[model samples]
Target: MRHRSSASANRLPAPRKRFGQHFLTDTRVLDSIVEALGDLSGTTVVEIGPGRGALTDRLVARAARVVAIEVDRDLVQHLRARYADRPNVEIVEADVLTTTLADLAGGPYVLAGNVPYYITTPIIFHALELPRPERAVYLVQKEVAERMAAPPGDKTYGALSVNLQAVVNVEFLRKVLPGAFNPPPAVDSAVVRITPKAEAAIEPELEERYRSFVLAAFGLRRKQLVRVIRTVASLDAERALDVVTRCGLDPMARPETLTPVEFARLVRALYAAPSSR
Candidate 1:
């Protein structure tokens, strides 16, 4: 019910480099992002880094309720004033990294954002760590998008790819060019949709172990799996190879070559083996 007035009147705040602010001004790309969300008529939408309320306006037009969380104080004031009359929109001044998703929306909701490039992964991880949302859409750096949706053995495959794949079905929606933003970013960006798989369930303890093992393996990515595992899991070469064999993986495989499931299997094997005790 509210609208962004002419910038000449309010004199919009400058995009801060520290906040990684890049205001999306392209109408076509904005429409595509909203369409990608697909029918959010009655769902609460949590938007992170709604710089100058460009994406926020579109979200408000469709979402049942829009909770716009802005970390930058300047933009927060602009959004609050812009949406002051819109009862459906709540402008929350908070850091997305520190704020819990549960605190923002009570029931079923979708998470959307033109996330800061530097903190994109943390934001996605935070959302996924919460009780799963219906879906999450982010306009992140193209490189990050590719990595999040990367398959095993792909050049971009690493810890992010594996950890995200272990829980969500990641889809790279579309490529957004740099010209789309007011002060365009040097690198291009892409929209990504992350949906939690219904059956992708991992217990808390196992999930922790899975994260630890995956991170350690990727930390020594250039090394063979056997040696990396030996160092990370504190196992000798024989024990490391044993875990790899139990997981149906080859001793010569590198960390980046293994799929998320493979990592989980290897972690579980190591945890259950007698030598791990």
Candidate 2:
């Protein structure tokens, strides 16, 4: 089994196309990503898609321990061999989406990754699920980084913006051009830091409802709040108007114009409405 695994690892390409692998090669960008996570002297870090171990090399040096999850079996084998001597580094051969970070780390951990562009959003929200990391630093598509950190009135603000902001403080760190990667992605990428709020804007019990409400509102973002509330909450037109008015929001206001706090208020008002009950 060991011999076969070694053979398989040798045959596979460094950056597999199917995995959407674009390995970060620029040392400066790599340093910037690591720096964004702050000091990791005694911290455990869960790194997603540690392709070719470029970032992992830096992580293992600084972090107390590094649990690097790689989906590719070939890369997993390669990584295990590369870091076999390093007791602090654990190469996990598992899908990051399926594996729980808390279970792998066995305690609190910081999340960092140069995530695949195609699955960036899913990977992020997946990580943000229960037992969230101490903080997360991701090298994601520039557009997505903008959306995550975008303000209420910004053009990039949408359901993603509201949902993420409701729980975490987002910082758009810096942008990386295509040349930074081995097989450069066509589009520019950016690094973003996500730190979960000490006091979430929405309570844990209400998170599901809050996410659903925000998605529903942005689903019909061009429409006025009155119509969106009426459609999504199954409230009558008059009741919808009343709900929006009571929430201190303009009935004619579009969803994009509302802040995360305003969205939470509107959702609570909708839930309280008699028709919604």
Candidate 3:
């Protein structure tokens, strides 16, 4: 005899752990996130990890073009099927890291997503550095959002904080409770807005060097800046001291104490020094 199906059995698909899927189900929160995009009229939006298309539905109505990139093959099919009639929406199955924004949408676009927590930092980096979206709005872990929006001296402030802020102006929109999601993540989530800096804080040519310098400084956070600089840049004691002095930072200051501007200044000063030459 055949058995009758229940709601669980008939449900589209359960959240997958590996994919870090947590579908945003709360309509109020969903509306707020879309509204935060401020004027989406005629704008192109590249949405990463559009699982179950919760935000996709809202985005399609506002954006002139909506390119939804999903890593999970199952969800890709689901999203495509769901929005099949919507001419404005295009769904693609691919890992966000390999996919370039230009390849997805040609014109200026905003990056939006409820990003996978495991790949949150990597996604943010990709969004800011290449194909460089005009603006990015994401639903990320509350702690991660705080770190990205953190100021110079906050406890959470470190490499991620400095790196992102050096490129974009970040804002923490608001906190989102776990109840807002279908699976309900263990921790709360928050929405963040990241706007690309009109002008790069560091010279475009020196971006790589600047990044290396910042990573080194934060690698040994407890040490004085001079010592951390010497270890990372392979500079001697005297050269490190000289570099610190040139940047006008106190010799005893720690890495966490320096702002992004200070970090850029130090990198430039070190590069210009004869010792570095």
Scored against the true structure, residue 151 in model 2 reaches a CA lDDT of 94
1-277: candidate 1 lDDT, tens digit per residue: 3475445326588999999889999999888888878899998998888888888889998989999899888888888778776899998889988888866887778888999988888888888865777888899999999999999889999899988888889999999999999789999999999898776634445776787778888999999989988999899888888878877988998998887877877877776445432
Candidate 1 positional error at 189, Å: 0.7
lDDT, candidate 1, residue 41?
A: 90
lDDT of 2 by residue, 117-136 (tens): 99998898898888889999
State the number of backbone clashes in model 1.
Answer: 0
Give the winner by lDDT: 2
Residue-pair clashes per prediction, in order, are: 0, 0, 0
List the RMSD of every prediction in angstroms.
2.7, 3.8, 5.0
Which residue segments of model 1 deviate by more than 4 Å?
1-9, 272-277
Model 2, CA-based lDDT: 0.88
Each model's C-alpha lDDT?
A: 0.85, 0.88, 0.84
Q: Which pairs, if any, clash in model 2?
A: none
Tens digit of per-residue lDDT, candidate 3, span 1-277: 1111333322356689999999999989888888878799989999988887778878988889899999888777667667766778898889999988876888788889999999998888877656688788999999999998888889999988888878789999999999999899999899999887887677766677888788878889999988988898898999999989978999899989888888888878866445433
Stretches of candidate 3 off by over 4 Å are 1-11, 272-277
